[model samples]
Target: MKSRGLLSVLTFSEKRENLLFLLLNEPKTIAEIKGYLNVSTPEIFPRIKEMETKNLIYKENKYYALTPIGKVVAKFFQPLVNTLHVIEENEEFWKEHNIEAIPQCFLERIDELGNCRFIENRLEEMYEPHTEFFENISKSELVMGVAPVFNPAYPAFFLQLALHKVHVSLILTKNVFEKVKNEYRDDLQRFLECNNTSLYVLDDISLAFVVTDIFLSLSLFYKNGIFDAQRDLISFDESALKWGEELFNYYKEHSKEIKSL
Candidate 1:
């Protein structure tokens, strides 16, 4: 019952939540709250009073500040709010994919993907590689990836990038590596020969993602274990790029480096 009441007060209104957020950073007087919230005294005072009654905040001199309990609540609310934003931003995409394929740590930090662009294939382009994705990655100087699926276009394009001195570090599923070793042996050999290239083979993985110097793109298997070639979640933000690097390393450490063949 106590927890229920606190949760209700914490989530009661956007204004209340905003007030808590404002106090999380610094103490503010009524005038400052009014200026930031753009609400009149009649509107702001009642919300402040409710928070005070809950002991979520306290007044010191002319300023309002979060109590220690309020600070702890503020800490709790941020990740919850950020997780909601990430799920809300791409509602359908998140709903249909196997989100569990993403490791827990990365999923918790989904907020890093705050600036993501969720691109679904057009009906006419349903089977084609995303032109914008290719164009954006074309300008990259370094690319790190984990792939569980293979496309016919990848071999030639990745080799072209490597030939032009772009650093390429990739981890491929055992099956995909076998397919490449047998079918595209020349291109695979040439790609591995580059001083700037590194390759690895790892199985028992279910997601494909790439992080480049310019952007990050993620692809995941359907809940039924099939890859969806139609949609891509891409982000150009530096934070997402950092997150992707960590994700790549997580799998890379579990993989076998292919110095050749």
Candidate 2:
């Protein structure tokens, strides 16, 4: 294939397409071509002359035939026509389902094409979606949040955090403290101790949040289960880290003296 360098030179119209198809069966004079298409000679002659001028066709005797470039152009455009035909064939079927979004795109493929898989979650599921409202926590130097103590998946995320060596201070509620004491406290405490991670016993605090120097990821729990409050994690870019630091500082100042659990 010759590279035309990102531009198309082909121009098309209904008349040209019809003439091209007719010529494909075998070349014929203008009179014969016009008669075959059920059109008068005057209507077909101008189109043939224009196609010849565009190098889409060439005249030999009184017959017109596709130029080499025109054949290549036709082949190149066939895929697009086939795709349109598919859409046309399914148009009624899609209309019946009331589906507004087309399924032709490859969003997940685009995301996974690079070295890492890019994951995205909905804003409604996050603790805060407003970029401006979370500005303070988005810039923190450190974060201390209360943990739910009962969530199974919470441990998985906590393990990931420990693996990453991200700094996050956790405060476990007394209700959580008692449960852990009765069951998983020893293992949980050992894990925390290994990381030199800080933990506070459940006191006045409400929920759990993991905070790093620049961002916060929060989770809360009620009788049902855990909900994300400070839902999305933010990065500690220079400016964002500065803002998050202020928020962390404010919380640190206001929080009651935290003792080791």
Candidate 3:
């Protein structure tokens, strides 16, 4: 098979793809592979033989391992698979929302959010605080957020967290900043006075997200430019948390810090 044919060898069969990823972690004998994959010998043997012919895997004593070429393929293939899974898992959310709010660099690493799950608010619950989001952040030692739109309850809620000694950081859009400064002036002042809190303001953005020591909560605007208050992507994975933090820093670098107001 030509090198181009190798792509089919890896993707055409789910069993073959699973076997490749199973072996990526460590070499495994045919019996171990069969048990781990829950496939019988008749089903798995042909895959091993085909992979052997493709020079993607080789047998040594009782073990089957990836060849040098196979390792290179797996290194790049895994990320693509993970990225697809992340988007496909929430196809409507990705399609309906303003994904352009995410910077290109971070969009390239969308696989990092593969472990996330959606938290949807019912229409009747739209005005209520996300109980899970608030509870999780309240327990976090550090919290960071980007707010493109204002939520009336957030000023006091986040201020309470800052007062409780949680290290809080926020990037607000110009309009949101003005709302906080004008309506929640006292809370904004005290939040800024806290040694543990920092605030920055930037021009309008099209998304909102909160990343904390324990979790990440991301929300986006609809294609019609309305903020989707009902759906959020939340993740507790370490990689997702790191991805969210880098996203916060990206906007933070572009925002101006508001020390007093």
Task: Estimate the overall C-alpha local distance difference test score of candidate 3.
Answer: 0.91
Give one clash count per candidate, in the order shown: 0, 13, 0
Per-residue lDDT of model 1, residues 82-146, tens digit only = 66877888888888899998999888899888678677788787666788788888999999988
The residue ranges of model 1 lying beyond 4 angstroms of the native Cα positions read 29-42, 115-117
Which prediction has the highest lDDT against the true structure? 3
> In candidate 2, residue 161 scores what lDDT?
53
Please identify which of the two predictions, 2 or 3, would achieve the higher TM-score against the true structure: 3
Candidate 1 vs 3: which has more lDDT: 3
Candidate number with greatest TM-score: 3
Error of 2 at 27 (Å): 71
Q: Model 3, range 30-123, lDDT digits (tens) per residue?
A: 8899999999999999999999999989999999999998888888999998998899888988999989988899999999996888888889
Q: What is the C-alpha RMSD of each candidate to the true structure, in Å?
A: 2.6, 19.1, 1.3
- Residue ranges of candidate 2 with Cα displaced over 4 Å: 1-145, 148-150, 163-166, 218-261
